[model samples]
Target: MSITRSQIADIAHLARLALSEQEIPVYAESLSRVLGLVEQLQRADTAGVTPIAHPLPGQRQRLRPDEVTETDQHELYQRNAPQVQAGLYLVPRVIE
Candidate 1:
C-alpha cells in the first residue's frame, strides 16, 4: 500500500498542510516507509497467541510500602520562612 505524490497532495489538502515541491518527495518516502511497516505487521501470524498487555508478567506492580515516619514538626518549618502568618507561610501577590 504505497502512497503517491497526488495522494499526498490530497492528504495535505485535507490536513491543511502547506508542503512545498521539495518537501513532497521527503514526506512521500517517510509516509511510504510507515505504511510499508504497517503492511508487514498485517502479514504476521497471531492466530492462537494470547495478547499480553505488558512485557512484564505480574499485574501487581512491586513498590516499597507507602509507610509513614515521624516527621510531624510544623513549627520548626514556619520559623525558617520570611513571613509567617497564623501557622502559615505568606508570599507577595502579583495579581490584581
Candidate 2:
C-alpha cells in the first residue's frame, strides 16, 4: 500500500499535528512502509494456531498472593486533619 502527500496532509490535519512541508514526505514514506508490513502480515497463513490469553502458553502468571502487606495507619495520619469521620477526611463542599 502506498500513502500519498494529500493523504498525509489530511491525516495531519485530522490529528491536529503541525507537520512541516518537508516532514510530510518523510511521514508518507514511513506510514507506507508500516501499512506494507501490515499487508504482508495479513497474507501469512495461521490455519491451526490456538489463540492464547498470555504470551507464554504453559507458564502460570506469577502474581503476589491476595493478602494485606501493610497495616492500617489511617488513624495516625488523620490526627493532623481538621475534620475526619468514619475514617474519611471531611473537605469543604465547593460545588453546590
Candidate 3:
C-alpha cells in the first residue's frame, strides 16, 4: 500500500495541484501512510455485525409534523406583474 514518486506526481496532476520536487516525497510518504491505515482497517473481522445509522442506542429520530404554514398569495403578488397568463408570469422569448 506504499505510494511511489511517480504515483504522487500522477495524483497531483489529476487533482490540479502543483507539487515541487521536495513536496513530492513528502506527499508520497503521507499518502502511503493513509493507504496503509486503510489497508489495516480492511483486515479487521466483522462477522455477524449489524451496521447502525446512529451511534447512540434506543434513540429515535425526531421529526416535525408536516403541514401548510403559509397562505396562498399568488393572486395578490401577481397584481404587480406586467404580464401574466394562466396563473403564470409571462416573459419575452429570448431563444430561437
Candidate 3 weakest lDDT stretch, 10 residues: 40-49
Spell out the clash pairs found in candidate 1.
none
Ranking by TM-score, best first?
3, 2, 1
Q: Which pairs clash inside model 3?
A: none
Report the C-alpha displacement of residue 90, candidate 2, in angstroms: 31
Backbone clashes, candidate 1: 0
**lDDT for each residue of candidate 2 in 1-96, tens digit (9 for 90 to 100):** 999999999999999999999999999999999999889777778889777887876898689999999998999999999999999999989799
What TM-score do all the candidates reach, one by one? 0.43, 0.45, 0.45
Q: By lDDT, highest first, what's the ranking?
A: 2, 3, 1
Pull out the clashing pairs in model 2. Answer: none
lDDT per residue as tens, model 1, 1-96: 678898899999999999999988888888999998888777779999899989877777778878996697889878888999998788788687
**Residue 91, candidate 1: how far off, in angstroms?**
42
